[model samples]
Target: MGIFLPNLLVIGGVLILPWVLMLFNYAWWRPKRLERALKKQGIHGPPYKLLSGNIIDEFRALKASHAKPMGLSHHILPRVAPFHLQTVKNYGKTSVTWFGTDPRVNIMDPELIREVLSNKFGHFTKPPPTSLLKQLVTGLVTHEGKKWAKHRRIINPAFHVEKLKRMLPAFSTSCNELVSKWEQWVGSEESRELDVWPDLQALTADVISRAGFGSSYKEGKRIFQLLTEQSELIMQAVQTAFIPGYEFLPTKGNLRRREIVREVKAILKSMIEKREKAMKTGEADNDDLLGLLMESNFKESQEQGNSNSMNIEDVIEECRLFYFAGQETTSSLLTWTMIVLSMHPSWQVQAREEVLQVFGENKPDIDGLSHLKIVTMILYEVLRLYPPAIFLTRCTYKRMQLGGINLPVGVQLALPVLLIHHDPELWGEDADEFKPERFSGGVSKATKNQVSFFPFGWGPRICIGQNFAMIESKLALAMILQRFSFELSPSYVHAPYTVVTLRPEYGAQLILHKL
Candidate 1:
């Protein structure tokens, strides 16, 4: 009996001890070590707590800040990123914070940010998406190394300027539908109080649906509906992300997420298969995004063989990214543009005048859209004030030196776009004010060649669809300016918050006066 018991104990120790040690390292030793490393470099932040780390503190701060809408103000760092702001204020611009034992160094300096994002030496890499995040999004955005290069190569041709020019009709079609719908709602009424937030979302979604899948929003409405639900569920799941294996359990949320992913993939797979068949039979048009991507894929496959190209599933993920990223960027920009323009009537007037002069009550053609410099300036300024993405994150997989600090492996880098945008040092004393003229001379002249104004990110890894987004925003804004003048409604609450992308909490209720 003693012999048997001792053997059982030995087996148990052999099987379980490694996992226990790993847990200890992850929960305690690693965090403490990283903390000491940062402290030694004269960078410090809120002391890390075990397991949950700073997540609980971040949650509490965000919850309290988001309890109610703020007044009409562009100083939204306090409302949107209270914890990060507090951390920076308490520690310094170059500070540290914990996201579940993972030390995230807040690098707000543009020079340092440039180095990290440029990744010239390939020292910094995007933090691997969590399983929950993977469920929500994956594709070129998530990949690294050869796989990323391959996907980017295949995807590049799809977003090239020439291809985007071809997609202009799709953008025009979507914008025309939206403004026409609004004109109908306004009817004979002098002005109409309308919440443009949801409507704008629908507009962008419809745009991506057409441009991406060569179909109307109604044709692929189910995919978007599933994605929206998945996004909400994923946001809730993010709260419990630090709890290891929490998403793997058969919890209701987890199960539903799984179901949503399955359905979404199924729908995309069917669409892709049909498209592939149509292309093979020469019946499909090669103008939309999907056609371009597939054509690019085929070209790559022909040159390097099938092994180098993305599979059907990879194609599906890219389509998903197109919908999410493409839709979110333009919609957020448009929504904020409406709200900000309403707040600053003079700039709105200037923008409308410029739009009127450029297009003169005509449908915005590509040439005229590009010539609307005032509208472009307004969009750039709005992006600076309320960037669709509040922050960009990356991680170190190997020990590396960033500026003067030695970044330990596994250290996460947070480039707080919102803070940098609103910094007095970066943008002057009137940084928070709505001044579109700051961008009148173009992005280069505005920032004096500094890597400061990157609403769509900076460097080679910058968003591929930035041009697509700017063009779409310009066309839509020009159309709206041609038709109606708008101002915030009495019921409108000025609360800009982040939900993947920064959005209005209480909705953008604006009174649209027919011009």
Candidate 2:
């Protein structure tokens, strides 16, 4: 018994000692060394606390920001990114904050954001999600390295501009239904007061349903509804993820998120299997996004003889991504466009004139949407002022030099898109104004050669569904302008907050007048 006990003790030390030392290294030594290095380089930020670090502070900041509504102004930096804004304001643009033991540097410089995002050698990649959070999302957005490369290859064809043009009918049909529904609701009143937020959500959801999944909106809307719930739950989990053992607590939010994720996965799997069966029976048109993805995957594998095709789970991940991304980005863009255009009626008038000139009372065609220069400008301006995603983050696994500062491994880079978008230094004197003229020439010309404007994101890893979103937005906006002229309702409260994406905190109620 004594001999066995000694052997057990020896084995325990062999296993536990290295891990304890590694924990000490990770939780103390390395962080301190990195902090001193950063401080020496003049990069300073809020001082960190033990294991909690800045997480509690960050949580408080987010809570305080979202606690009450703000004035309806173009300045959204403070509202959408309270913590980062306060940190930047207090500690300059390039400052550090602790995410647990890891130091996350806030980089407000456009050049630095561009370099990190356009990383060619994979020096920077998105930090892995927490174990619980990973279940909420996956696919290309979460992938890196060669897996990302292959997925991009197989998915590119599905989002090609020409392919998106073919999907215009789906966009128009959903939009037409929304227009008809709104028209019916307005009846004969000079104007109608209605919360268009939910309607817009449904419209975008239906568009994604028909265009993405090759099914009726009624059939696919569950995915949208559940995914929306999932986003909120995901945010809840993100806020509390740093709390060790939080996932095991069986909290209501935790249970709800887990439930929502399961529902989403099951729905996606069933739908994907249905499409796969249809394709095998030669009964599918291969037009919808999912069908096209399958066709593309098959064609690539057959032509190139590559056996490394994405599995069913991988395809489901892509579907989830497409569903969430396709819905969120366009819906946010459209929602903001509606609200902003309502605020500035003159621009709305001009955009309507442009749309009318391009397509009149007819449905907007793919070709004519290209001629919607004014509408395009307005859309770009909204993206600049109220981008759907306010931040982009990248992490390093090796010590490296970036933007004249040396960063150690395990350091995270926080690229605040909204801060850079709203910067006066980069965008000029009227940076806060809602002026579409800045982008009249183009994005490159708008920023005057700075990496300032990337509403859809910048670099090779930029949003692949950008064309689809743009086309969908143009068709919907063209139709909305054709049918109604709207202004902010007296009851409308301008509350824009980020729940995964920038969204109207209060429902967007508008006073709509039939043209």
Candidate 3:
């Protein structure tokens, strides 16, 4: 019996040794197979490291480079690495880089971006593994396949032109409040150097609350604060999560992120539950985004006879997305526009003149806003310069051909929207310079009849709220221009970075002059 026991132990050890070694090789020693594949195809980038790939080294280089004083152009590079922007520039427009174990990167070619965004459900889909972000917000933005189709179908009506027209009143009210506040600051004083960043943030939050939730700014403001806090923590996690085992450690930032997520979810839940109850009792008001979405979703669910059409949880997720996406995009657009206008007072004067011509001394209505062509051009130019969402990403589910390259499955594509928007080849030699007149004849003419301008994205999955955002932005711009002339304050630091969206790292400060 003793001899048999010894033999059994020996056999078990012998069998387990090879498996353990194989696991180790898979985790650490194996060369990044994707990097090798790219090299073999005559594509090359900075050499990859073992398991961590180029993340740590690339980030170090990026941080060092960014530490120096740089113009608006340098902000386009990787402020933190996987030096994606530099890598793409070095390895041609369509190139790949390693994000830890993941093989992903910039597909700067306009055609490829079009293919990925337009041909949804073909070779790519929204990557399913979104870490903890999916738990916080998973509405139309993250959904795919049949789920996306259904959500898109139900949510479409809420953002239709007529629907947006109804929400214009909400937009005007928010803009009025903002103008009133700014007026107070400019009372009897020729000018006041105000940080328009916070004001824009508050204004957008108010718009989303009144336009999206049918609730007052007070409720929406609370949600916006929580969302902003949550986004900051998430951005930090994304920066460090590329390192191995970083997420598992209960760091201060991670704990705070979890808390923020919890608070946001709780707030969303209470609002949704209350709205749902009110809806059931026929006391729901369709004044804001929440009410409209709920009312639309409930009716659709009943009509479809599917219990899953638009549940309370789904409605809450949509609301969360609205708060984050809607508010952030508009705020970024307005802030950058203000800065650019300040830089070129000529354009600012032109835009303000156009606004005054359209709606002098009275609130601009939706119809009046549509005719403000110069304002639209300036906004489009601002969007080109500092697109709110810097990049869009997709994961390949099957081996597919993109721009004549045979892309293998599991390869992730990072389509840098800002890079594409700012590409000299696409937008001409003066791409980096701010010139609103380039868009005088609309986007098609702006790009010399190319399909390169996609601020809200492209194809089937383009932002559903794009029209709503545009109208809201135009209205807000007109209102601000009508009341005040502003310029970047001397103390303002022009540090633009991506934190879920392209944001001025230091808040955009400007001196507001009462017109």
Over all chains combined, what TM-score does candidate 3 have? Answer: 0.92
lDDT of 2: 0.86
Task: List the candidates' TM-scores in order.
Answer: 0.98, 0.94, 0.92
List pairs with backbone clashes in candidate 3.
211-289, 212-289, 212-290, 213-289, 214-288
TM-score of model 1 (CA atoms): 0.98
The digit string of per-residue lDDT tens for model 3 on 225-274 reads 98888787786676666565677688898777777767777887888888
Pitting candidate 1 against candidate 2, the one with the higher TM-score is: 1
Window of ten residues with lowest summed lDDT in model 3: 73-82
Cα lDDT of model 2 by residue, 247-301, tens digit: 8787898888878878888888888888888889998877899999988888877
Model 1 local distance difference test score: 0.90
Model 2: weakest 10-residue lDDT segment is 128-137
- Worst lDDT run of 10 residues, candidate 1, spans 215-224
| Residue 404 error, candidate 1, Å | 1.2
- Clash number for every model? 0, 0, 5
| Residue 97 error, candidate 3, Å | 0.9
